[model samples]
Target chain A: MSRASWQAFREGAYHTLPLILGAIPFGIIFGTLGPASGLSVEATLLMSLLVFAGSAQFIALGLVATGTPVGLIIAVTFVVNLRHLLYSITLMPSVCHLPLNWRLTMAFWLTDETFAVAVSRMAPEHRTQFHWYYLGSALAMYGNWQLCTLLGVTAGQWIPGIENWGLDVAMAVTFIGIVVPQIKTRPKLLCAISACCLSLLWHDWPHHTGLIAAAIAAVVLALTAETMGQKKETSLKTGSKTT
Target chain B: MTEFILIVGMLAATYFVRLLPFALADRMRLPAILENALQYVPIAVLSAIIAPAVCLPEGYFWIDWKNPYLMAGLVSVIAAAIGRNLVITIFAGMATALSIKFLIV
Candidate 1:
């Protein structure tokens, strides 16, 4: 609300400009897919506004199209979004000083892009208005997503079977883009590889539960890999220290 | 009505998952092991979603011999790894997939 905070906020929004460009196609696709998946326009918009998770929304649409039980749909989406918990954990130290409401807003607005942008922008430890900057980025992404969803919904009616045009492949590629940068470590690479293989192997599982199983497997493997890594690092440190 | 509840359910679940950590993160410290595991959640989950979607586009168990989706996905991944850009990765993947799909299929 202060001038400095306002400026930080605006700057955060400005940082999201490139991310917004990437998000436009995704949002439009979600909107286009929603109606084609048999969701009413209102329902699709409402989902975008309230749920606000692109991947989860897409999974929900797939499950809904298959007439999967509501409980199953909810479960699948919940598991898919469990990654946000990690984002909050990563971000907690940076914004721990903020009040509960601000924290809640940040969490609600947290997405892959916003988290990546906001975390990078929070370098100045002494700065008081980093939360405002985060809010700016979050709000920018949030607004862009909703607008693109709206456009996708409107464009959906005029375009038939737009969902079947292999666009989901693009999403898969987007997943690759997200994965490649993060696999800098052996554990991360293993986690990614195992999860990918298991996902294909588990593809036949009922109720789309394979995703959760694959994720859990990946996490378990990653933990094992990381613990071994830590042990090795500590031993090396101790060895060097003694010598 | 069912759709609305589903939407609400999704909203509640998403907020709840995203919110609990934000709220509790300050109150409690995550264990070191748990913290390390949590770090992998994003990569694991994204791969879990992408692998099947690309490898088995048609159904629970399906793989085309040439696998245009798979081929295109690999191209995209290579493009992204080399370019370090999302737009280029997506466009390149899309372009590869569409061309293979049209040319071969």
Candidate 2:
């Protein structure tokens, strides 16, 4: 590869290294849990390949293991992943100039980690290279995930103290790392608090439907708060002008 | 046969959900209300996952003060809020939880 391409790859790898580290334990947990939940080796690997989502896949496995209806499992997965819609929207302008093939390829790898890193680095002027950087980050993450899962599946049975590793805490820590930085406004804070409360209250709902309810509640609360804030701003401006 | 059918149906449904937004996003101009709603989707979904995991570790409404996950999560939050590196936050939280779990649980 040319020096520029190699540099791009190195930069992308450096940017995404933290995400890969965080994802390792997550991938191991999923790999171990998949087989323990009655999924065959093929099925477990296929899930990592197709679904490619850590939390959603775990929820789906639980539902499937519990013999929840297939329809419900699919629906819940869709709801849980609805945030990807927002990611795509935010990324659309940056990626619109790419060819359809490249766009589609990049879309397949747009996980939460890639989205966080890519969005933070995206510049309005250098929109074109955003896809290249995105692809590089995605490739690194995807490669690491596959390797980690392979190790987890092969040695998972004999890994005596794997469960004691506290890898599960990584997910929560990663989310806190991402979310706390973005909670700079009152509306965002309200939305987060409201969603957490609603989720806890509705935790007993079947088929993981409580998550959907929480998401809807947060969206409604945030939108209402934003609308009210805008109206108050307008009223203040009008009153000041009249005075 | 049933399992195969279910898997196929799920794959199709998932693809459809993913494709629907991309297909319609260009053709249909989303209204202001809908735009506003989309803004909270991430926080909402994240809270849905995190809150339950922390608040209900025993798979019920039982709250335990000695819960390592909860304590570690709180630490992680504080660390993140202070703008610590992501790796450091995760390591601190995970190590704390593992030590607590081993010592206590």
Candidate 3:
């Protein structure tokens, strides 16, 4: 490989290793649960490939297990994945200059992990290359997900003690690790707390609509807190001039 | 026929939701309030998933010494917040959860 290509490949590999490791147990759990959830092997594998989202796919699987109506399941999945809209919005300005094929390919691989790594590392100047890096990270995650799901499906019941293995906590831990550092302000803290409370209160809502509502509530709360903070700061500055 | 239609509809709906913001951002200038709202999206979505998973273990709201998952999750959150390392935090959380499950239940 050329020097730049090698660097990109290496960067992608290094960035994706942790995500793959985190995803393995998750994939295995999904595989183990798929049959019990009444999903055929082909359907399970297809869902993994097509959805490629860990949490939302699990939520969909749970709904499917309960024999939810097809329309409700589809609607819930759509709502559960609404956060991806935010992701695409954040990434578009950075990746717009890329070729159409590359843009679409990167879009296909866009998940929380890949987007996190890509957005965090993107520089203001070399934003064009952000898509390449995103492609590398996302493609690596995609490969791991496919392989792990294949392994899980083939092994099936033979893959013992997956629940006991504590793989489910991996995603939560990873999320907390990613999000805690970013909660550097009061408004962000309020957003987190309010969202958690709202979701808990509305957990029984059908189609997981409570989640979407909680997300909306958090954004509103944060915006309000931010505006109030700004007003206070402005008032303080004006009062200091009189004093 | 129903299953096929369901899958197609799901694919369309998911893609529409994912694409909507990008299309809007391209066509119109978003207000500052909307931009700030976007900033809270990740945390809100994440907490929405995490809270119920941790708080409701038996399909109901039950919190007590018997529930190790919640205890472990709390510890895991604290550790992650303080440690800020993905591998360490995950390992700590998993280990705590497993140990608690085995010991308590």
- Specify the highest-lDDT model's number: 1
The DockQ assigned to candidate 2 is: 0.49
The residue ranges of model 1 lying beyond 4 angstroms of the native Cα positions read A1-22, A66-76, A116-130, A206-209, A229-243, B1-3
True contacts kept of 1: 0.79
lDDT of 2 by residue, B24-52 (tens): 44455666566556556667667767777
Best by TM-score: 3
Against the native chain B, what TM-score does each candidate's chain B reach? 0.78, 0.80, 0.83
lDDT, candidates in the order shown: 0.80, 0.72, 0.72
Query: Could you tell me which 10 consecutive residues in candidate 3 chain A have the lowest summed lDDT?
Result: A95-104
| Pairs of colliding residues, candidate 2 | none
Model 3: per-residue Cα lDDT over B10-47, one tens digit each: 66666676555544444455565565566677777777
Best by DockQ: 1
lDDT by residue for model 1 (A1-243), tens: 788889988999997776676577778889988877889999999999999998889889888888889988898888778767667776766777778888888888888778766666645563488788888998998998899899899966587766666656766777687678778889898999999999888888865578778888998998888888889999999999999
Flag the better candidate by DockQ, 1 or 2: 1
lDDT of 1 at A49: 97
What does candidate 1's lDDT look like per residue over B49-99, in tens digits?
Answer: 788877888874556547777887789789978988877887888888888
